[model samples]
Target chain A: MSPKGPAPSSVVREFIKDIVVDNRFCFSFPAETSALNKSVASFGVINPVWIVKSQDNRKTIVSGFRRYNAARKAGLETIPALTFKAGREYDLFIAHVAENTAVRKLNVGEISRVIFCANEHFGHGFEKISDRLFDALGLERSRKIYDMLLAVAGYGPAAKDIVSAGMSLKAAYRLARFEPDQRETLCKWIMDNRYGTSKSSLMIDMIDDIQAVKKKSVDEIIADAEAHVSPDMEKPQRSSRLFESVATMRNPILARMRRDFQTALESLNLPPSVEVIPPNNFEGRHIEFVIRARDRSSAISSFKALSKVAEAESENTESSKLSGLFGWI
Target chain B: MSFPGFSKILIAEEAVSTPLTKKAKAAWPDIAPQIVRNLADHELQLDMEPDPVAAGKRTLALGPNRGKFIRKCPGTMGLVCCNYWVIDLVEGCPIDCSYCILQGYLTDRRIRLATNINDLVDEIDAELAGGTQPVRVGTGELSDSLILDPQLGLAETLIDIFRTRPRATLELKTKTANIDSLLNLEPADNIVIGWSVNTPAIISSDERGASNLHDRLAAARQIVKHGWKVAFHFDPLVLHDRWEEGYRRVVDDIFSVAPPEKVAWISLGAFRFHPSLKQVIRDRFPMSDILNSEFVLCPDNKMRYVKPERLKLFRTLKNAIVAKAPSTPLYLCMEGIEIWESVFGGSPRGDKNLCQVFG
Candidate 1:
């Protein structure tokens, strides 16, 4: 539709006609269109239809495969669209993105494509591209771009299936922080039923370890990563059932220090978390201490005493390392 | 807008009207109520509180410099005002921006609405009264310049104050539609009215309680229509989803409202936060995805985008801004020397400042 043409109102809906996907401006489905159609039927089209005017003047769908399929499934001949004057395929792709992602939802892949194409097309960084898009969209959509980037990094590609395909902004941001290779791997892993969202963070941590130690050998990186994995994130190796019978004595060093702090409190018997240890590990960070008490006054008193002890310990520990270590001992 | 979490207040018994003040009242009335309420809310203990200004202070000092001290703004070669001079004004803003550093740095969480305008003027007058070189200054370093315009009429008074001294110019940076206090003022080539802007998301999530981006652009248009030199800022440019579209919209919107020739200058700053304030901001804006960007520590220990990332953002923003405001002076805030060299291709200077381009 040309800018000079009349805008689509409720009445214009009747005049709107169905168009095919064989136009010069159209692109193919990245995945299964039928499945996408099913998803859209069950969920809904998250992003709008990207269309371009065919030589014959029919508005042809350029993007939004799911939307097109859903429309087909619904036996609809036409869909809502604002046609673009297409030139460069990349530019058209970006325009398609700006049209929908501005106010609607997009997957990390779609967002990354636009950002990547923006740099490739306009020759700029994600920040400038983001700002430029922000200014163009009037700021609201620009904020979504920031969130999308975080999603891609945090969730990786599996996020595309679990989050982006469904258009969950929160999940996208959580996935964006992971390395691209890891994202793809985890995505496949999730697809193959090896892991789920519950194990997502653990997978991401393993990826982070690999990335951190990339300069070392792959074996070294994996070993280091394996050593650091909390028992929760990694499956413990079973020694033919011999290791299962050994009486386990698990003692958190920090918990021991915390117990000492509680003993010092005496009648102050504070909550397990409130007793502050010396600032050996958690220095310069505000800690959340829950002081469960019989009453508010005792809680208050325990808080005061804990604060005093923490403050004194922090100072003493800073001045003398030996005392700091010994204090904990 | 009501300044939430405000505990301390200072009342200004004196009613002063300058052109800038009148303009501000006409621009944003929401700000006036908060400013006026703050003045009435606090106890007037004395004629003046101690100026807690300190020499060689860090960048994260909250408002209320305990002592009156003079320090140069570490502004680079070509920018207008020194950033440090403005830091001495007030801390804590009532306006919320998801990207605002105050979200992280300001512990008090209340608007430290500074009422010691007289003392500030006196100190500025004494310092720059006979200084040999021209001194560039602004009030937006700590708080929104016109947030208190209705009650204090600060811009008008400051414009009038600066009229006597041609060497110094006061730039009031804001994201509000507060131009009334500035419209009627005798247009001073020296006094620059700047508006901080970003993608719509920046305004919505980062700049909560502030005017929408369109309103700000409209306000800038009003200023230019009234024959005042204007400026725009994309400071704390956040990396967000569809950021390209967002920034493009901002640039196009600005051009539609005010011609490039009407602009004095434009600034581009990538999102940078103090280490201490990151958690605060995260807690305050739990849904904000800004904290998840690829960040590296600067020499100041503040978290900023990597140099490559900064350069990339700078280049993209600069190219688009220059398309319309080609001749308008552009600079970066709190960026390093290498970035300046890489992005703009040359160092910026005072003669190269916005005043030189549009003054």
Candidate 2:
């Protein structure tokens, strides 16, 4: 149904079921929908949802999917929408993207969906879409960005959630390379554990390594990690335990070093007021000694006590032999 | 040299008159050579883009060797250095191993072919003439020794030079099967051709554009058959499942084809690299699991497998090799004295004892 004039001048009331979410701009996170629902329930949708007539005469939403869903949840029978007359498919796609861009910035995944829809529905290739259409739609104009977005778009829903939850684009791309079921489990674990981006990336790498080197299935690896967490532990504790277990499995060397360092520290038997800190990641040669003294006399005593302990321990350890040979100690 | 990654050749005006540049042109006939007054002109073309890695892979620059060609290997202070010297030949590698430190170590990605081989040979000769002590030198430090051998033809020149110097031994280490240039030349007892080997699984997955383990072993056999001493480097030994069995098969494969008497020395080094190489590998080889394993930044600023893990890997491989070839001399490359004591029960006193085996 072509518009008789320009577009609808006034907002038209349409039945909630009659408007279909456009596949091109259908991407939405659960939290986004929940917030929109709360906003609609309290003050109602402040802006009109944009819609266009489809080939079968049903109204398809160009933008404002969260508004329509929230309005439905708010117990509204109809929602305000600006209906447009059917025009060129590309023009319609651009209108959808433009309206969304006008409201707020579209995320990477959302931009990917727009590209996917434009490619599928408008027959624009990635090169054409990235070069010509991206500028017009106010998206970043770069082939690399377009390629990365398209790759992320191919990830399953759970993986998409992981990206939306703050995993980096590079990490998301790596996660997309896994098997569908494995990707879902890993993404779900990341989401459930509330892993930060760096941790999430590390966890993904751990899983990938275990799968490759051990030839274990993703289910088996996840099960092994789950076994490390006790049933009595809460969600956060369980997640932290699982992460530790995975890390141990990934780098048995680091685990052993940490154990060795702990043993070495225990052997020193320093006073409670004296804290000896090992180098971070065992990177530096100098071990930091912190004295928790409130006065100068106590600090001096702590330092003297630490020096005696170190000297005595050095004589007994293999490190002391090297120190003696080099005259370092 | 035929790889599609590099499409252009930029030759320094000074290098255009060198025999090495002439050889490069002869090797790659299809690639029209572009001559510039200096490397700075070529750097101007690269300044337009931010992605040096991508640009480096696409351009091959030829220039004279302005720095010392014979230099000491950068060994860490606390580590037990083997006193290995390096003969700087090329600046980049064509074979794209996932764990290559060159990815992060090199500033740019361009394949830098030094066109001043005569100067390099002269410097090596001078070093050998001035010193009475035995020295071990290798060409695989900055780039693979034989990966570009077919195009450069520097291996024969190096082999001839080391043949006359009794105190100097030359090591040509590579992961490729490009030994056609060396096969027909006279075999020198002082020249050791080594292959960087790993399990078959790693060969297929992580080592891109490299020869498979079977072919590399076959090349080793060919080199030994031609009366040259060969070496095997299970360097960057990966800790995979059934690793004992995988390494056992590799050890068996080596002994079955070539005798241990013809072997020069076997070196073992677990996979290690600069921390930055981890992300580079993740981006370049998404399917690779090499970076997923545990690594700690050692005092030397390189990420290495923990001591226990490295010890276990070394002991296992050492046992497998000893079981097969009891007489073959074995050493650890770029490792600390503690690790040496742990594996061999004692550490080499200095470079003197270390070079005695290979020299």
Candidate 3:
């Protein structure tokens, strides 16, 4: 129940160098041992690091990675430890999960490792993963989510850094579908540019569409998409521009229809208060106009303006122009 | 093997003495049938197979129909109903489509056949016993009607049953071309042979183990010549580059072989699936590009094309089909009034020709 993990018999000081950073059972983010280093330098290890005797008689650190790292950094000759005889690979790995999940929240990268290890332990899939495992990690019990975690767990180092650096798990999952180098390029595009979760997701969907339609590698698609974006634009505008570029590449015809419709509407140049709402997917037969009027006279003026646009008889009239929108649908 | 290409014969103990099991044993004298007392408890430990679903697919199981085999199609909520009926003659399809709903929800994943044809026929008779109205019953909802029909001669047996009841129309829908059994039999107006169709591009990319577009059309041509009323289902009209051209060509191909008059009906449905099937397609068929589309969740809680795109796709295909054959009793499957009106200018509920079946 304690953050330090369940107490085992016979805590003793073991040489810091003797504790190997056993990645086989590790579930921690990159070391953040600065404060711990200063603390250990002053106070020494207040808690014992958990280790198991490896098959070859070497001591493997199962938990307390941060404390171990800090002790090594603080130039300690030895640190207090709890030792156990290794029973099973999965059991030892689960002990690592329990120790860290008890003390702090695991980042997406660390959680990926947990899920990856669990899936390996299961020897098939995590389809039968326990609700307790998900609950213990403060996650929604979903195969889809766990599948994403398992995928990210196998991701290249660059993606791991991005996941650890705080990319939303959903965005990372989408990006993970691509090949490693392609994923690295997209990771740079997303993380280096600091695209938020929503933007990152939209951008990835657009890229996915382009890749699917063109049947090109994702790297080529990203390269082509990024070429259309401007370096001079501000961040949000740049993001919007990149999205539009990729979206256009995804569906050029649909995108052109929408753009042409926007131009035609702008040509009407209705008052700022009068807004024309395009049909939803141009589905069904409906177009709408909104007139936010302060007075009845302004409302009348807005209607009169709509009437001019709607009631024109000439083939070249604005009404006829609006008819083109219907044709697109 | 009753069903060829199956690696294992999992038999329900209840089906041990059934005609189907006898046919299976007589066909394959070598493989032993694993008789399961409760199929629910029977599990396939196919861990070594990289894809358990694909491996499970290669396993066949014959079982008693646990529930009613004949039922009205549970069409999604808010979708137009054609009043079509379905008989679960088989429990799973051998032809794998990336968008198949089976990938998401079929609990018993192996290809399972209903061993009690007599009970199945009895259930069908009870449904159509008193009905003077023509009823359209099909055998492709849960499984392709003809995937295993070649080995079992399921078509000949079911057609024999329906031929006696002139009012009960039986349709066997499939993606396979194994119609040799049905060819020599007397063709009845009540018995229609339907085929799920798509563009050749789609067939090559997504439909694994199914007949190619050309072969399917050829099979349809032969069936029509044999005097059976044939139907076509462009159920998953997928959107891709040059999709219009692809669909137009297939439409031309359809009219060329199966003439408009001989065709009983043609149904158009966009590629729709449960959202979770996306992962299955990605895992099983990574080369599949069908998931790369703009999809929106609909009222039925299935992912379909966006309304505008859907309307556009339907209108384009409808126009092409109408140009070739204006009176083919065209209808939209699992679609609601809004789309029907948007594309056809009225709902199927109002069309007199379609109303006879759906009214």
Per-prediction TM-score of chain B?
0.77, 0.93, 0.95
Query: CA lDDT of B150 in candidate 1?
Result: 51
DockQ of each: 0.01, 0.17, 0.20
Report per-candidate TM-score of chain A alone.
0.43, 0.83, 0.72
Kindly give the stretch of ten consecutive residues in candidate 3 chain A with the minimal lDDT sum: A123-132
Local accuracy of candidate 3 as per-residue lDDT tens digits, A198-218: 666667666765676677877
Q: Model 1 reproduces what portion of true contacts?
A: 0.00
Candidate 1 residue A297 C-alpha distance from true site, Å = 75
Q: How many residue pairs clash in each candidate?
A: 82, 3, 1
Candidate 1 lDDT for residue B172: 84
Check candidate 2 and list the clashing pairs.
Answer: B56-B109, B56-B110, B236-B271
Best by TM-score: 3
Over B251-333, each residue of candidate 2 has an lDDT whose tens digit, in order, gives 99999768988887888999989866766776678788776556677877888876667778999998998887776778898
Model 1, range B37-80, lDDT digits (tens) per residue? 33423322211112111100111111233456345655544233
Of 1 and 3, the candidate ranking higher by lDDT: 3
lDDT head-to-head 1 vs 2, winner: 2
